[model samples]
Target: MSAESSGGQTPVEYIQHHLTNLSVGEGFWSLNIDTLFFSIGLAVLFGWIAKKVGDSLDPDNPKGMQNVLEVIVEFVDSQVKDSFQGRNPLIGPLALTIFVWIILMNAMDLIPVDLLPWLASLIGIHYLKVVPTTDLSATFGMSFSIFALIMFYNFKVKGPAGFAKMFLFHPFSANNVVVKIILMPFNILMTTIEEIAKPVSMGLRLFGNMFAGELIFILIAILPFWIQWIPGGIWAIFHVVVITLQAFIFMLLTIVYLSIAHQSQDDH
Candidate 1:
């Protein structure tokens, strides 16, 4: 069954409406305004809260939000310390930021699908996508940033000669000069594919999970209001676990990738 003529929108149309981003610009340079706004807004919110907690922190008398914030900090720090070896000073803070930012973005899925869109409608905005992780461009943008960092660390730790050797002589190197020449192209191709796959996989994984979750919520929204609660309530309960797990996976992979980059050739 489909929703009855919601402002002339069919069930499919309603879902599409919810999925559309409030975008600007055109073609290759287009920007999803809603995704950017919500993501940056949530990140700023987290920083403000963190700063307040830090300024007011009491060692012996931690309570309320202070205790909660401390727990989150310790948890992220522990994860980074355990997984990251030969770490930079930035790893712990980076892990914490990624974990918190992703959680906040994923948490947007828990909000009622129509609430924000309906509210935006009242203000004359037709489209407003609240969840940033559901946007592939946003997810890919983050993953590519991480990928660039990985590349930088690769060069820094291994040096240019060693990094170049990673591609040239990896996986299928030959001792013979002629044989090595024949294999060089193949080796480089495979290595390049492997390196590129990391960020593509990371970005797509988060985007796929979040997009599916958002789709389910939109589907629920088109159902009768009273009956909608059944699936909506169950999905909402289950999604808390999903959101947290996705954030943890992203953080853990980041630590592991950086750890691998920091390793010397002999470690493998």
Candidate 2:
């Protein structure tokens, strides 16, 4: 913690302050301003940079950021090509956006944990969380948005009857009409649980991993100033892998989920 934010607080207090957000209002109206600020700011910046770099394509001699971006685009496209069952023009770009945006947000955790909050405190903003993936609200927001797309594709590919078939006939079909009727409620219950589990698991997994990482950084910060660099340096090195893997896993799962949605029961 900086002199401004840390003040005379105990270690527990310091950690609490650092973990909290610059929130306002309460209940349904509540908002985490720092989470919104950083996540949206990074997204806008990413888009602007990508658009500028994209519009000035020099395929003959790509270099610097263009080379790096080309690598990332190709990597994301390859993953989509592998994971998605069929073709949807949107999947490649969506995967690229999710991967890069999440990686950018997760990268914020590498900033000396106290640095941004300290700076914010200097400007009279007391609480700030730089990492959006560490926040459940933000993670769930993205996951549920993906979940919506999953539903959309399910409808788009399978139609209303297909959805009903899955709900009523999946995992318990029968030649006899009476047996199929008997299994409808069970199939619907199981299918409902399966559907709910997807976004919940996805959101919680991202939140849990990133929150633990952030907490460790905070704990390292409260250590003796002189020796903090030892563990901090090691963990920062390892966290590069953690942040990148988290982004990739989220993006891959999104592709997989959408691909599954695109398949009809007969395809299964």
lDDT (tens digit, per residue) of candidate 2 on 1-268:
4323467788888888888888999977899999999999999999999989989999899988899999999899889988899989999989999999999999999999878877887889988999999999999999999999988888889999997887898877899999999999999999888887899999999999999999999998888777789999999999999999999999999999999999986874
Name the weakest run of 10 consecutive residues (lDDT summed) in model 2: 1-10
Candidate 1, residue 101: how far the Cα is off, in Å: 0.4
**How many residue pairs clash in each candidate at the backbone level?**
0, 0
Instruction: Look at candidate 1 and give me any clashing residue pairs.
Output: none
Model 2 segments beyond 4 Å from truth? 1-5
Backbone clash tally (model 1): 0
Task: Write model 1 residue lDDT over 1-268, tens digit each, in one string.
Answer: 2356358678878888888999999988999999999999999999999999889889998899998878888999999889998959989899999999999999999988877887898999999999999999999998999999989988899988879878887768778999988888888999899989999999999999999999998888788877889999999999999999999999999999998889875563
Q: What is residue 70's positional error in candidate 1, in angstroms? A: 1.7
lDDT of each: 0.89, 0.90
- Against the hidden true structure, what lDDT does model 1 obtain? 0.89
Give the TM-score of each candidate.
Answer: 0.96, 0.96
